[model samples]
Target: MADLYRRTVLVTRPEPGLSDTGFALERLGWEPCLAPMLRIYSVPMKQAGAVDRVIVTSGQSLEALRVALPPATPLTAVGARTAERARTLGFTAVDYAEGTANSLVGHLGRAGGRNSVLLATGRKLGVDLAAQLRMNGWRVTRRVVYRTEATESLAPAARSLLEQERVAAVLFYSAATARAFLDAFGEERGLLGSVRALALSPTIGRTLGAAPFREIAIAPRPEQQALLALLGPLPTSDTNTARREIAP
Candidate 1:
């Protein structure tokens, strides 16, 4: 733990939520380098029809949907954090998926009675969840409540720190951020080679691929607590061979 002191960890999430990650890192005595890899901006979309259930892939898309949809509308989220946020927003029927939108789609199919759903999502999506549900005969009202453009550059401070080879670890919350980070820093393979990547899920790790980091450790869960758990000393290999998440 002596080596963990003040070690810089690059946090790549959009603003507002970026602050949350910063605070969490600060609590752990880790220096957080803020270099948002995606710009989350709200888009004015219409109020969804009799929204039987609301599907939220990203927490940033919640605000727009809350305003557009009714208060008591049931909500389903891709992660625990999003589900918790939805519950706090006066939503009673809040459920969460352990994984991505694809996981949520399967969860919904078995949950039953979620006939009509307003999928409050960002413009950019890794999986076409709406289309998947539509093919299965579910009424999916796909609402792009937020526009996410992949960030192509980092802040000068973050860039300088990376160039200096000072970034010890990187925290990736989403697949989009993984792509964006590589987009901006793929050329600096030398800088990236020594850094450890802590990804929120398997998909995020796979998206990052094996080229960038010395080692990639994936959290057991997709929640913040799970991601933060990897802040300590990492093992040489994972014991869970059946679910080999870590990539070398």
Candidate 2:
């Protein structure tokens, strides 16, 4: 069994997601230190008119929309989680593709008959989706429904773990989050020599740039479960030993 401290991981996703991933890590017997690198803010947007369909890339976009459109509006989501969120927000017609913008674009391409589509997304994001859909004969209207800003610094717990060199890995969910983390801690890249950098996608992994991590691994799929799988299973004996010491 690895030492308790050696099993620690730094979670760099923003809240809601941060808590969810941390809880999953705990269930897998890994210690997770919550460290949100980005702050998400809802950007109020006005829908000029109704559209045939709406596309959402993240749950944050749906939350920002505030269900302004009718509940029966046909919605296409980038992933199952976003589709679930759309349902929770009262949208009756919802469907999703594999967890990536490219997959969503392909899914729409295969669906035939192009129509006016509203792309609900974060500020300065989703350009590729809009462009691809337009190329495929869909009139796409892109709306910035939310904005993400980099936090000023790492959480105290995350900083302490890095300083002690106890963190085994750092999980990154988005390129924005990874960039935000770099903005906050780029000067200390050397500290990551013994830390593994785990990213949800290749794009996110590339965002880490030249950070001297012991290794950098990208998830096979752009989903939380795939990202967590990169950490492998924790030993049962270590799970019990760490649980007793770390339990609140």
Candidate 2: C-alpha RMSD to true structure equals 3.2
Predicted structure with the largest TM-score when compared to the true one: 2
Model 1 TM-score relative to the real fold: 0.83
Q: Estimate each model's TM-score.
A: 0.83, 0.91
Q: Tell me how candidate 1 scores on lDDT.
A: 0.75
lDDT of 2: 0.81
Cα lDDT of model 2 by residue, 168-229, tens digit? 89999999988888788757778888788999999998988668888899999998898899
What Cα-based lDDT does every candidate model obtain?
A: 0.75, 0.81
- The clash tally of candidate 2 reads 0
Scanning candidate 1 in windows of ten residues, the lowest lDDT window is 239-248
Instruction: Quote the RMSD, in angstroms, for model 1.
Output: 7.3
In angstroms, how far off is 117's CA in candidate 1?
Answer: 1.1
Question: Tens digits of per-residue lDDT for model 1 on 1-248?
Answer: 42333267788887646878877876666667777888878988776668678888888888787677667777888878788777777777888887577778788774346588778777756248888887776788887888888877766777776667666788998888888888886566566876789999898899878456878999997778888888784332222111101110
Those runs of model 2 whose alpha carbons end farther than 4 Å from true positions after fitting are 1-4, 110-114, 240-248
What are the RMSDs of all candidates, in order? 7.3, 3.2
